[model samples]
Target chain A: MSLKVENLSFSYGPRKALDDLSFALAPGSFTALLGPNGAGKSTLFSLLTRLFTAPKGQITIAGHDLGQAPLKALAALGVVFQQPTLDLDLTTRRNLLYYAALHGLRGPAARGLADEALATLSLTDRADTPARNLSGGQRRRVELARALIHRPAVLLLDEPSVGLDAASRRAITDHAHRLADRGTTVLWATHLTDEVGPTDRCLILHRGRLLADAPAGQIAEGTTLTDRFLALTAETA
Target chain B: MTPDPLHLSPNIPQGGPGGGARPPGPAAGRYLTALGAILHRELARFLGQKSRLVAALVRPLVWLLVFAAGFRAALGLSITPPYQTYITYETYILPGLLGMICLFNGMQSSLSLVYDREMGSMRLLLTAPLPRGWLLFAKLLAGTLISLLQCLVFLGIGYAWGIRPPLAGLLAVIPALLLTGLMLGALGLLLSSLIRQLENFAGVMNFVIFPMFFLSSALYPLWKMAEASPALARACALNPFTQAVELIRFSLYLTPNWPALGWTCLATAIFAAAALYGYDPARGFTRAKG
Candidate 1:
C-alpha cells in the first residue's frame, strides 16, 4: 500500500467528524473520494495530510507511519489544499521553485525540475506570469505542477476543481488521471461524480462513514453515478 | 517523446508496502536549504511591500520627531547609568524608539502570520519536511532580520535628527538590537498562534502593544514610573519590553546591562517554546479551522 488509513476516528470537541474510517491505496492507482458537503471528506483530507492528528487511528504513507515518522511520510506525499495556497504576488515558476526549496531541492537542480514540471503541465508559457495574472484554471494547473516538483509518491488534491469552469475542470481531472496512469498514487476528493471515471476506485462517504468502496462502475450498481450517489447519501440527508 | 513528469523509473525507489524508499532523513544540508528558502521568501515579501516598510517607520518617527519634541521639557531626566551627561529628551528616548521599531515590527510579522494561516500559505510552510521548531525559529529569525533593517534605518534617521551615540556605542548596539528583535519576534510568534483571525489582530495591537509599550521603560524610566505609582512601577519592571529597551539603552552607551540581557534571553526562550507548543498539531490552534 502506498497510503493506508486504519480505523481512523476524529472529533471536533463533542461532535465526531470522522468515524472509524479505513482505506488503503496501492501505488499507481487513482481513487476518487466522493462525498457530499459536510460528509467528513475535508476532515478525512485533514487527517490524511496531518493538518489535524487523528485521535484514534494509524495513517501510513509510503511505508512511513505519519505519527512515528511525519517528516518521511510528508516527504513522500504531495497535497493541494481546498483553499488557494499560491502566493499571488509570485510568478508561477517562482512559486514552484519555492516549493522545491521547501523539499530540499535548489539551485540548478530545482530550476531544471521546475522547468520539466511546468513543461509537463503545459504551463511553460505562463511560467513567468504572476499567479494573480493567471486565470483560475492556470493557477490550478500551476498548483498541480508545484505538487509534482518533488515527485511525491502519493498525491492528494482536495476539491481541486472547485470554482473552475467545465472545460478547466475536465482538463484538470484528465491530468490527474494521466498522473495516476504514470504511477503516482492519487486520491482526488470531490463532491462531483463526473470527476470519477468508470474504472477508477471510488469511496463514497456519508456522515463520517464509508458507504461504499469499490470500482466506480460497481459502486453505481445498475444506475448512473449521479443516481447512485444521491441514493446513497439521500438516506442520511 | 518526452517522458511524463509523473512517471517513476524502475531505478527510483518505490515507497510501497515495505519498500526501501527511505526519505532523505534529516540531512543537515536539507535543513539549511529549507531555512534559507524560508528566509529568502520572507525577505522577498518584505522587499516587495514598500507600504509595510513605511508603516513600520511612521510610528517611531512620529514618537521621535513630534512626541519627543513636545514632551522634552515636561519630562525632566536624572543622570542614568547609560547617560554620563545631561541629554535632550529626544536623545533619552532614542533607544526607546528603536525598541518601538522592533516591537511594532514583531506584531506586524505576527499579523502577517495570521493572514497567511487564513490564506493557506502557512500550510505550505508547516508541511515542509523539517523539524517544526527549526521552521518556527527560521520564521522568527526572518522577522528579526527585517526588524534589524528597520532599526538601522531608524538609527540613520535619528542621526539626522541630531541624536548621536558614540560610534563604538552604535556598533555595540547591534547585538543588543538583534537579541531584542528575536525576543519581541518570538512574542509575536506566540501571539500569532493564539490569534485565530486577522480581524482579531487589531484587538491584540490595542490590548498587547499599547499595554506593553505604555507599561514598559520605552516612554519613561522605571524610576519615573515608580515615583508615580509603585504598583505600576513593578509592572513596568516586569515587562520584557522594559528589559529590551534597557538593553538597547545600555548598549547605546557601550555599557553592558547583564540583568536586561538575561531577562530578554529568558523571555525569548519561553516565548519560542510556547509558540512551538501552540503550533503543535495535538494541542494548538493549528488544529482549528483556518
Candidate 2:
C-alpha cells in the first residue's frame, strides 16, 4: 500500500471521531473518501498528514512510517487541506516557490519546479498575480500547483473541490484523475457523489467506520453512488 | 513500498538544497531553506500590512509624546550607572517602551499563529518534511526579526523626539534588543500553544500583556515602586520582563547588566522548550476543527 492507515482510532475526549478504521491505497489509485460532515474523514486525513496523531494505529506513506520517520513520510506526501492556505498577498508562483523551499528545493531548481507546476495547472499567465486577485477556482488551482511543486508521491486532498463552480469542480476532479493515472497515489476526501467517476475507486464512511470500500459502481446495490451512499449511511444509523 | 524513482516527475530538477544526492529525511540544508522561506513570507506579508508597522510604532510614540510629557515633572531619576548625570523621565523609559513594542509584536505573532492554526494554513506549514520544533523556532525567529525592525523604527522616532542616547549607546543596544525580542517571542510562542483558541487573545492582552508590563519596571523604576510598596518593588524586580527592560536600559547607555542578560536568556530558553513540547505531535496536540 502506498498510503496505509491501520486500526486508526481518534476521539474528542470521550466521543469517538474515528473507531478502528483501516484502509489502504495502491499506487496510481484515486480513491474518493466519501463521508458525511460528521463521518470522521477529516480526522483520518489529519492523522495521515500527522497534523494529529492516533494512539492506536499506524500510518505509513510510501513505506515510511509516520511515527518512526515523520520527515520521510511527509516528504512523500502532499496535502491540499480543506481550507484555503495561500497567503493572499503573495503571487501564485511565490506560493509554489515557498512550498518548494519547504520541501528542500531552492534557487534555480525551485524556480523550475514552480514553473512546471504552474504550467501543469495552466496557471502560467496567472503566476505573478496575487492570490487575492484571483477567482476562487484560480486560487484553488494555485494551491494544487503548490502541492505539486515538490512532486510528492502520495497526495491527500480534503474537499479540494468544495466552493468551486461546476466547471471548476470538473477541472479539479479531472486533474486529480490525471495525476493518479500518472502513478501518483491520491486520496481525495469529499461528500459529493458526482465528484467520483464510475471507474474510480470509492470508500464509504459513516460515524467512524468505513462502511463500503470498492469501485464507485460496485456500491449502492446496483444504484447510483448518491443513492448507495445515502442508503449505506442510513443503514448504519 | 518505497517511492518509485520512476514515479518521480521528470519536471523535478536534479539537485535539492543539499547540493548532492537527496536524503530521505529532513536535512540541515532543508531546514535552512524552509527557515528562509518562512522568513521571506513573513517579511513580505509584514510589508504588505503597512498599518501593522504604524500600529506597532504608534502605541509607544503616544506614551513617549503624551504620557511622558504628563509625567515629566512627576517622576525624577537619580544618576544611575548608565546615566552619568540627570536624565529626563522620557529618556529613562525609552528602553521600557521598546520592550513594549516587542511584547505586543510577539503576542501579535502568536495571535497569527493561533489564527493560522484555526484557518488551516498552519497545517500546510506543518506538512513539510520538517521537525515541528524547528518550524516553531523559525516562526519565533521571524517574529523576533520583525520586532527588531520595529525597535529600530521606535528608536529613530525617539531620536527625533529629543530622547537620543549616546551614539555608541545606540549601537550597543542591538544585541540587547535582539535578546529581549527573542525572550518575548518565545514567551508568546508558549502562550499561543497553551491558549485554547484565537478568541482568548483578548484575555491574553488584558491579563497577560497589561499585568506583565505594569508589574515590571516599564512605566516606573523599581525604586519608585519600592517608595510606594516594598512588595510591589519585589514583584517588579522579579519579573522577567523587568530583566529584559533593564538589559535594554543599561545597554542603551553602553553598559552591561550581567544579571539581566542571564535572566532573559534563561527565560527565553525555558519558554522555547515549553513551546516545543506543547507543539509536539506525540502529545496529540489539538487539531483546529471546522
Candidate 3:
C-alpha cells in the first residue's frame, strides 16, 4: 500500500473526532474522502497529514511510519490544505519557491522545479503576479502548484475546490485525476459527490465514523452518486 | 494519443538538490528550507504593509518625544548606574519605548496568527513536512528581526535628538533586543494558540499586556516602586518585562546584569515550551470547531 491508515482514532476531550478510521490507497490510485460539513473529513485530514497525531492508529505513507518517521513520511506526501496557504503579498513564483525551500530544494534547482510545477498547473503566465492579484480559482491553482513542487508519492488534498465555480471545480478535479494518472496516490477530501467518478474509490464518513468504503460505481449503482450519498448520510442523521 | 509510463522508483534518493521525489536519507535539509520559507513569507508580510510599519514606529516615537516631554519635569532625574550623570525623563523612557515596540509587535504577531487561522494560511504552514516546533521558531525569529529593525529606527530618532548612548552600546543592545523579542514573541505564540477568535484577543491586551507593562520596571525603577509600594516593587522585580527592560537598559550602558539574563532566558524557555505544547498535534489548543 502506498498509504495505509489502521485503527485511526482521535477525539476532542469527550467528543470523538475520528473513530477507528481505517483505509488504504494503492499507488497511482485516486481516492475520494467524501463527507458533509462537520463529518470529520477535516479532522481525518489533520491526522493523515500528522498535523496532530491520533492516539491509537498506525499511518504509513510510502512504507514509512508516520509517527516514527514523520518527516520522511511527510516528505513523500504533498498536501493542499482547505485553506489557501500562499503569501498574498508575494508573487506566485516566490510563493512556490518558498515551499520548494521547505522541501530542501534550493538554488537554480528550486527555481526550475517551481517553474515546472507552475507549468503543470497551467499557471506559468501568472507566475509573476502577487497572490493578492489572482482570482480565487487562480489562487487555488497556485496552491496546488506549490504542493506539487516537492513531487511527493502521496498527495493529500482537503476540499481543494470548496468555493470555486463549476468550471474551476471541474478543472481542479481533472487536475487531481491527472496527478493520479501520473502515479501519485491521491486522497481528496470533499463533500461534493459529483467530484468522484464511477471508477474512483469512495470513502464516506459521517459523524466521525467511516460509513462506507467501496468503489464509486458500485455505491452509485443505478442512481446518481449524490442521491446515494445523501441517502446514506441522511439515514444516519 | 499517448500515455506516459507509470514511474515507480522507490530507489529514488532523498535530499537531491532538486527533484519531485523524496530523497533517501533523513530530511535534515527541510528544517532550513522551512525556516527560510516562513521567514521570507513573514518578512514580506511585515514589510509589504507600509502603513503598519509607519504606525508601529510612530506609536513609540509619540510616547518618547511627546508624552515623555510632557511628563519630563514631573519625573526627577536620577543618576542611576546606567546614567553617567543627570538624564532627562525622555532619555530614561527611551528603553521603555523600545520595550513597548516589542510588546506591541509580539501581540501583533498573535493577531496575524488568528487572522491566518481564520484565513487558512496557518493550516498550510502546520501541514508542511517540517517539524511544527521549527516552524514556530522560524516565525518567532522573523518577528524578532522585525522588532529589532523597529527598535533600531526608534534609536536612530533618539540619536538625532542627542539622546545618544555610546556607539559600542548599540552592538550590545542587539543581543538584548533579540532576547526581549524572543520572550515576547513566544508569549504571543502562546496567546495565538489559545485564543480562537480575534475579538477575544482584545482581552489578552487588556489583561496581559497592560498589567505586565504597568507593574514592571519599564517606566519607573524598582527602587521607586519600592518607595511607593514594597509589594508592587517585588512584583515589578519579578515581572519578566522588568528583566527585559533592565537588560536593555543596562546593555545600553555596556553593563551586564546576570540576574536579568537568567530571568530573561528562563522566561523565554518557559514561553517557547508552552507555545510548542499549545500547538502540539496531540494536545494542541486548536478548537474542534475549526
Candidate 4:
C-alpha cells in the first residue's frame, strides 16, 4: 500500500473529529476523498501528515509506520495543505528551493530539480516572481511543483481547488490525475463530485465516518456522483 | 506484495527529503543543509521588510537620542564594575538599550511565528523530514542572527553618538549578545507556542514586554530601583532580562559576569525545553488547531 490507515480515531476535547477511519491506497491509483465541510477531511490529512497524531490508530506510508518512523514515513509523502503554504514574499524558485532543502535536497542538485519542476508546470518564466505576484492559479501550480520536487511516492492534496477559478481548478485536477497515471499514489480531497472520474476509487466521509468505499461509478450506480453523494450525506446528516 | 511499484522515473529517486541521494537519516550534513535553508529564508524575509528594519533601528535610536537626553541630568552613574569612571547617563544606559533591541526582536519573531501558523507556512515547516526540536532550534538560531544584526547597527549608531566601547570590548560583546539573544528568543518561542492567535499575542506583549522591561535594569540600575523599593529591586535582580543586560554591560567592557552568564544560560535552557515540549506533535500542535 502506498498509504494506509487503520482504526484512526481522534477527538478535540469532548468533540470527536474522526472515528475509526480505515483505508489503503494502492500504488499508481488515484483516489478522491469526497466529503462535505467539517467532515474531518482536514483532520484525517493532519493525521496522515503527522501534524496531528491520534492515540487510537496506525498509519503507514510507503511501508514505514508513521508513529515508529516519522522521518521515513514523511519522506515518502507530499502534501499541499487546504490553505496556501507559500511564503508570499519569496520568489517561486526560492520557495521551491527552500522546500527542497527541507527535504535534504540541496546545492546544484536542488536547484536543478527546482528548475525542472517549474519547467514541468510551465512556470519557468515566472521562476523569479515572488509568490505574492502570481495569480492564485499560478501559486497553486507552483505549490504542486514544489510538492513533486522530491518525487514523493504518495501525494495528498486537501481541497486544492478551493478558491480557484474553474479553469485553474480543472487544470490542477488534471495535473493530479496525470501524476497518478505515472505511478504516484494520489489522494485528492474535495467536496466537488465533478472532480471525481467515473473509474476512480472514491471514499465518502461524513461526520468523521466513512460512508462509502468503491469505484466512483459503482458507488453512484444509476445516478450521478453528485446525486449519490447528496443522498448518502443527507441520509446520515 | 511487490516491494515497490511507483518507479515512474529512472532518473529521479522515489524517496523524498530523507531518501535517495540524501543521507540515510538526519545526518549532520542534512541537518546543516536544512539549517542553512531555514536561515536563508529568515534573512530573505527580514530583508524584504524595509519597514521592519527601520522600526528595529528607530526604536533604539529614539531611546538613545530623545529619552537619554531628557534623563541625562536626572540619572547619574558612579563607577561600576564595567564602568572605568563616572560615566554619563547615556553611556550607562547603552547596554540596557542594546538589550532592548534583542528583547523586541525576539518578541517580533514570535509574532511572525503566530502569523506563520495562521497563514499555514508553519505547517509546511513542521512537516519537514527533520526533527521538530532541530527545526525549532534552527528557527531560534535564525532569529538570533537577525537580532545580532540589528544590535550591530544600533552599536554603530551609538559610536556616532559618542558612546564608544573599546574595540576589544566590542569584539567580546558579540558572544554575550548571541547568548542573550538566544535566551530571549527562546522565551519568545515559548510564548508563541502558548499563545495561538495573533490577537492574543498583543495582550501578551503588553503583559510580558512591559513587566520584563520595567522590572529589569533595562532603563534604570537595580540599585536605583532598590532605593525606591527593595522588593522591586529583587524582582529586577531575578529577571532574566536583567541578567542579559548585565552580561551585555560587562562584556562591553571586557569583564565577564559569571552569575549573569549562568542565569541567562539556565533561562535559555528552561524556555527552550518548554517550547520544544509545547510544540511536540503529540502535545501542543495536536491540541491547537493548525
Note the Cα lDDT for every prediction shown.
0.86, 0.84, 0.84, 0.87
Q: Candidate 1: where is the Cα deviation over 4 Å?
A: B1-26
Taking the tens digit of each residue's C-alpha lDDT, what string does model 2 give over A108-127? 87897788777777788888
Q: Per-residue lDDT for B46-160 in model 2, tens only?
A: 9888998998889999999999989999888888777899989898889999999999988998899889988778888888889988888889989999999999989998999
| Residues A174-226, model 4: lDDT tens digits | 77777787788999999999889889899999999999999999999999999
What does DockQ give for each predicted structure? 0.37, 0.34, 0.42, 0.35
DockQ score of the complex predicted as candidate 4: 0.35
Candidate 4 docking quality: incorrect, acceptable, medium or high: acceptable
User: Candidate 3 overall Cα lDDT vs. reference?
Assistant: 0.84
lDDT score for residue A183 of model 1: 82
For candidate 3, report its TM-score: 0.94
User: Tens digit of lDDT per residue, candidate 1, span A39-131?
Assistant: 898888877777668779999998899999998898888899888999999999999998988888888878987887788787778899999
Worst 10 residues of 2 chain A by lDDT: A165-174
Write one digit per residue (lDDT tens) for candidate 3, span A107-187: 787898787777767777899999999988888888887887888888889998878887667767777887777788889
If ranked by lDDT, best first, what sequence of candidates would result?
A: 4, 1, 2, 3
- Summarize candidate 4's per-residue lDDT along B171-274 as a digit string, tens digits: 89999999989998998898899887888987866899889988999888888899999999999999999999999999999988999999999999999999
Give per-residue lDDT, candidate 2, residue A42.
85
Candidate 2 residue A24 Cα shift, in angstroms, is: 1.4
Name the weakest run of 10 consecutive residues (lDDT summed) in model 3 chain B. Answer: B1-10
Model 1: how far residue B31 lies from native, Å: 1.0
For every model in order, the fraction of real contacts preserved is 0.33, 0.40, 0.42, 0.41
Q: Where's the lowest-lDDT run of ten residues in candidate 1 chain A?
A: A165-174
